[model samples]
Target chain A: MVTFALHGVGVSGGIAIGRAQLVSHATLEVAHYVVPASRVDHEIARLELAIDEVQKELTELHGTMTRSGDLPGEFGAFLDVHWMILNDPTLSEAPKRIITEQRCNAEWALTQQMNVLIDQFEQIEDSYLRERKADVVQVVERVLKRLMGKPGSLPTSVAEERTILVAHDLSPADVIQFKQHHFAAFLTDVGGVTSHTAIVARSLAVPAVVATHNARQMIHDGEMLIVDGTNHVVIVNPDRSVLSEYRLKQSELDLERQKLKRLRGKPAETIDGHRVELHANIELPGDLAQVLESGANGVGLFRSEFLFLNRAGLPTEDEQFEAYRAVAAGLAGKPVTIRTFDLGADKQKAELDGLARVAPNPALGLRAVRFCLAEPKLFLTQLRAILRASHYGKVRLLIPMLASVAEIDATLAMIDQAKESLRERGEPFDEGIEVGGMIEVPAAVLAIGGFLAKLDFLSIGTNDLIQYTLAVDRSDEAVSHLYDPLHPAIIKLIALAIAGANRAKVPIAVCGEMAGEMTLTRVLLGLGLRNFSMHPAQVPTVKQRVLTSDVSAIRPVVERMKRTDSPAKLAALLDKLNA
Target chain B: MQIREIRLRNAKGLHARVAARVVKVAGRFRSRVVITVGERRANARSIMAVLMLAAAMGATVRLETEGPDEQAAIEAMVAVLAAAGDRA
Candidate 1:
């Protein structure tokens, strides 16, 4: 076979060599033909039965998703849409009318009705609306597949085969279903980085190349293919040398991963004897497993917002208490710093009742501490839960987006109130629980002394600090490039915060995207940031960086870089330090 | 017939999720409901029809209902739309 390669967006990073398995788009070739009038009722009944089967399948898929502790809110909504479409009069009633009037088969009749809907969608001016045609197509195809006796499931006989799945397109639901079967990688002719398939692939740590445009057509079944997800390239029928090179590269990666695992129990101390405390920032209670596997020193930032997200209604105090207790107990006595529900901003989904009015710029609007303070009842419930959980383990409360002394005062007052309520109810809680403040806002960094005076410790949230200092919304595509974490002003602010924490004799930790980043770890260590919190997946690699970081030696270099105003010089300095 | 004019409220607009919400709310009442956007009208209860209406974020559309529960239907839809509009 001739050697060739195809390029596409490599969304998820990994490598896999497997036989190609084509997953055809649900598009069916419906034969248009007149049916005998006597068989029309049978045809309609067949269509109804098929629709019933599809609904049952979707409902079961939804049930499976919910039981798996996945985002039922998202998958359930999609399934509900498909179910509604299947039961729609236009699909069921109109198709039956077509079958009787046109004397057509159920498949042909359904196709006729689907075309009418697609035509209407095609006329819509909005591109997003135009995209709904695909959803309609998927639903119609599911019905057609059922009518044709093709179950919407992977062939179990092929489960043992190492194969790369090639599809015209895949919905998020399809991605989840495919995950059950062992596929070497995923290749789709249609999708982007934001597609559900791509997102799932990344989270699953599977190789994926999407938007190949013609992968399903060009790649034949059982053809040997190399899916290089890291480069977004797929080599078809590679030469022996090329295959050997890839084999060598794969082994190297495997060995490197093995070496990193060896660092799990090792302390994140430098060769020069600087002991850096490495911790994990957990978004959900489920993330505790990864934290413990990564052997992080403790849970530095337990984002308590998970209970409020991806679902409707506020969790009761008991629900919150149980979630907190699970995390605290799972940590097995490691210090877990739980940040209160930092609602608003990007977390608009967490606001119960959706009562928070739309803000032109939510990042600067009613968010974090402001939102919690405004919703004191909700705040108190969460506070009481955290306090109760503290009794199980070393739990601390950390307030996010603190800028003013008055906000700190208000939060402390509420904390006291929550404790009083718990005390009045005779609830057991750790009275000696330490409360920390997040120095994210530039103003908070400047006023660190005031915050440190009242709080037990401080965690510098560099994600927001960089954005606030640069006056750029890092998420905004247009101005995102301007968000410089290593800007002179940002470095100065961090140094100032560290200086303030030292003078106040308060422990300081850096917890944000910057904290986990290998490129910035040495610089952070040089700045006297002894405590670091990040995703558990990043722990081992960051620990590796920490082991090599000589704080005593790099401090002077970091000091000089802090004084430099030139962006070019700063970039050069960072390169040297990271090297 | 009871008719009311409302703007799309959901910041992400009348996407699949918002359209699904609209369909669910419209399905609650006994009224025969139709929503008109620009020159196109769609059955309020059909997910496909609602999605096809393509009202988009901040787009003003007319909601028409004619049945026993016309007022209740209109109130529910208008309330949902306004809530969706409130989402950032």
Candidate 2:
């Protein structure tokens, strides 16, 4: 028997050696034909029935995620889009017309319509939005078959044996389905470091490799393969010794994962009693499930842009409210700070479609608050929803990309208008909701007095602020190494923001990717930041770091960082403090 | 219409169980209800819709509803939100 290695996404953390079971994403289009004009109404009814059936299945599957809180809000939105896509005039009518015009079968007609929708989805600018093309294709392929009077089938099937699951990118639902079967690990050809697939894999403790451009092509149905997720590598056809070595490593990984699970729900305090805040950055409302599982203090950063990104048009206010309310309610009485839409120049979700705002350097261009002001109505819809959600619990409003007092004023004005709409419309609301701004831009740091004067709190968005300051995208391989938050200027900016907030007696927090890092926790704590928001996976380490630190002891490092001229020097000075 | 800023107090913020609770409370309002975190928005009445925001405990989000039963819907939804991790 010939064995081959298949490269796929490593969704879970650990590795395993098992037989391969390839479940190819299906091509469900039916080639059958025969349509008469008199039967168009019958065909339409059949099509609607098929769409409803798919929607029902989707709705039920959607419920599982909602219950798990895996990604309720945005996932719900995607379903809504599916509902919309299923209901699309072109998608529905094209098939009937083709049946009438070409006398083709429902399956054949639908296959053509699917192509049209795929073309539209592929044209979207946002990578996340573009990736949705596959979802549409899969759904259409399934729906078209049903219209053609074929037995219903899954878009993709799992192998019956313990196999390494492979795909371009699997959704959280896919991961759950995979769990029902025996899978050694997950391997996928698609997804970014921050994509949902990776996040789910990390939570599932599945070993996954993403961005494996040729995974589907490189791997066969059954193969001897090894997936090293941490290193982002996939090896095919290993010798017997290498396979045995990885098998042992896989067992070891399982033990480590068990250790991580044990840390769940435990307070992440160090030997010393210093406590730190551990928060997660959430994209969809469903991801809150993992947040709760991780026992984080609360959400540090709530990314709402995902709701609007993949859809065809702007979501209504009611749509916004439903998403916010579930999350606010989910957290019970804990504080949830929702950052307003932070879609930069690159993410165009229809309204901003084809509206290029390219600067000589997009990293330093008109984005965040600038984009919000340029689209006030869109901004107002989100603010109104958040304002309404504030009634449910302790909800804080956060604004991103505020470089000046002016942007803050403008954003606040929108909130006020939202509040007025509620008032004029006789709506009840919370008066105590706190308003905050992310201090990432140097301009915000320089104008701290102005920002803190009006804003209630500040969260240092070190990632973007540093990227903008250093003119480097951490994702850019060429300049990623230069994207250091430890740079003297970056550190100084953070320090200035923290010092200003502390002096003003206003609370300060950091919610960037850096805030979750162990190396940076001390530096931030030393800078007088008590509030933090990061990924759930990082909470323990950050908390451990915080506990080891005496809040009082951090001042010395802050002092040293200020004295250092270069980022390397600053990092060295701070490293000595941790030492 | 009813509007409010609510903090997630439950240590385990908005998982599936909480989404059910949210849907139950939000469904009482005849008004179209929407909740927002930052710029992201979703329908509060549906569990699948609500879980997408991925909001964690102690985070802040906004909830608002407009309909014939807006006030009652708001109060009930807020109450459910406040009671998320408390008991049921």
Candidate 3:
């Protein structure tokens, strides 16, 4: 068979070889629009019934998704949003008018109304508000088919063994159903670069290739293929040589990944016994599985914002406590630092009502402590959660975006309130939960003395510090050249944060993309920042870097960078340090 | 009910890296999807389809999908096509 190899976007990691079936995604087969113009009321009633059926499915899916003690606070919140949309008097009432006035099919009517809503969402300046359009559209798509009695036709139930299904995009519903069968791999055409589908695929370790153009049209049924998740390579039919070569490489990668697994329970130390803390930056408690797989010392940064962003509304104290408790319990004896939500103005996900605030630059806007101060109730619930979770494990509460002594005082005051309430309710907690602030803003770096004096510990968020100090958006291609973490200013500020924290006899660490980079690993080690939190994949490489260097030997270069002005000189210094 | 034939203009064709990129991008739409490259065609919605296309570094293929999202379907396909080529 003539084999074809394809290079596409790799959203998830893994490898799979399977036969091809150029099966496009199975879509709902639209039956002919049979509704008479005269029998609009009767047709409308039928549409309502169909919509009701989909609503029932949506609700049912929500209930089935929870672990006995573990509530899906985020997804449950999404369902709440869906529930509201389902019963929204305006949306419900408008469709009827469309049916009467347009005399159109209910599906068409619903789609049009959704378009108007999506348009209004798009008009809002906030990207998060606009992204909500996706959720709204998803709910409508579910309801429309039910209303028309042509509820979307799900894919022909197939035993997914050795079969890789490709699609443009998948709804949360399809993902749940697809997981039931043992799929060889998955591919999609459209998902936000860092979308939920990508998150799910990665979580499942599915060899997923996304963003393949016309994937639905390009694949036929039961054709042999290979999906290389490492480089996101996919091979359809392979000649003998390529096939044999890939089989070898696949085995090698498996063995290599397996070898890394053995590194678990081993200390991340240099050949000469220079121990370094290698903790993982876990966004969710579920991420603990991979963190342990990588043999992380602990979670250096638990992004608690996920609890807020993942859910639809504010999570209750009990709900937040349960989620945090799971993470804390999973860590067992290891330390897990929980960082509170750092809501900023630019992020539409905040959903703070009636604050017409647009900052000239969100990086410098009312974010983190500033935003938390603005919404005390939101901050208090999270504080209560972290404090409650502290009893379960070696948990420490870390706050982000701290700029002043006042922000620190105000934050602790709320914590005090939470403690008082818990005491009143007679709920026990770790009263001695160590509280700390992340040193990210330039102001925080300058005011480090006051923070270190009051705070229990510190973790430096290098991404923001670099962005704020150097003024660059690392993601924007236009200023990609400006995204230099090794800039003398950034290097100096980090050194200052580390030095200041150490002087106060407080432990400090760096947890950002910069800490994960191979080049900067040694520089940070010499700067007195011994703790590192990074992506799980980056842990091994960073550990490798740590093992190669003596921190004492690496200090001179860090010192040299502080005295330099030229980028060329800095590059030369880095090459020397790496050498 | 429609089919559009297009050439993969990017010099790299549908290489492994490009195919993964294409699959990642194509997964964003919601329509019945498929593609054909020569006598072999796979579900464009399947990683196997684009991988099967193996249209070399620069090749041509046809795309088809049927649904209310067909327009977005075509545009997103072409967008990934151009992006995959560029990335490749």
Candidate 1 per-residue lDDT over residues A1-579, each given as its tens digit: 888888898987778887887765545566677888898889999999998988898888777776764332445667777778887888878999999899999889999899998998899876656866877888888888778777773434364346788888876557668656778888988887656667567555678999998888788878888999989999988888998888888878878879999999888898799898999987666566678888999999988766654333456678788778888988898999999988889854623554557788888999999999998877888999999999999999999999999999999999999999999999999999999999999999876768988999999999899988889997688999999888889888988898789777899999988899999988888878889998776788899998987888888889888789988888998988987
Off by over 4 Å in 3: A1-64, A68-71, A74-165, A178-187, A206-252, A345-350, A353-357, B1-88
Q: Model 1 chain A, poorest ten-residue lDDT window? A: A153-162
Q: Using alpha carbons, what is the TM-score of model 3? A: 0.68
Clashes of each: 4, 109, 88
> Candidate 2: misplaced stretches above 4 Å?
A1-20, A28-140, A143-162, A169-185, A191-207, A240-272, A347-361, A550-558, A566-579, B1-88
TM-score of 2: 0.70
Provide TM-scores for the models. Answer: 0.71, 0.70, 0.68
List each candidate's DockQ score.
Answer: 0.24, 0.02, 0.01
Top-lDDT candidate index: 1
Show where candidate 1 strays beyond 4 Å: A1-67, A70-101, A108-141, A148-150, A153-179, A184-199, A207-250, A304-326, A341-343, A346-358, A375-394, A417-430, A566-579, B1-88
Please provide, for model 2 over A1-579, each residue's C-alpha lDDT reduced to its tens digit, 9 standing for 90 to 100. 333454434444456565444445445325565767677667767877887787676677667655655443455545545544564456666677776777666666778777776676565444434555565675675576566554333223354445676676665445445434445566667776456656556655566777788677667767766777766677777888778888888778667656666666677553445566678888767667778877788887888876653333455677788788878889988778999888765544424433445568655676777877887877888888898988887789999888888787888888888899988977677877799998888888888999878988889888878877887888677888887767788877888888889899998888987887888777787777778898776776676566567766667767888777876777677777778
lDDT of 3 by residue, A1-579 (tens): 566666677876667776653323322433335367888897688667866776777777666765422324455545545555565544566777888887877766677777777676576443444456666676776676555443442434365666777666776565555544567787766654345556666656677877776665556567677887668777777777777887887788778777766666667786656788998887656677878778888899887666544432355677778888888889879899988876774434534423336778776777887877888777777787788888888899888888889889988898899889888878778988899999888999987889988999999998888888888887677997898887888888988888888788998888888878888898888787778998776687788778788877787877887778888898898898888
Candidate order by decreasing TM-score? 1, 2, 3
Q: For candidate 3, what TM-score does chain B get against the true chain B?
A: 0.80
Q: What fraction of the native alpha-carbon contacts across the interface, defined at 8 angstroms, is recovered by model 2?
A: 0.00
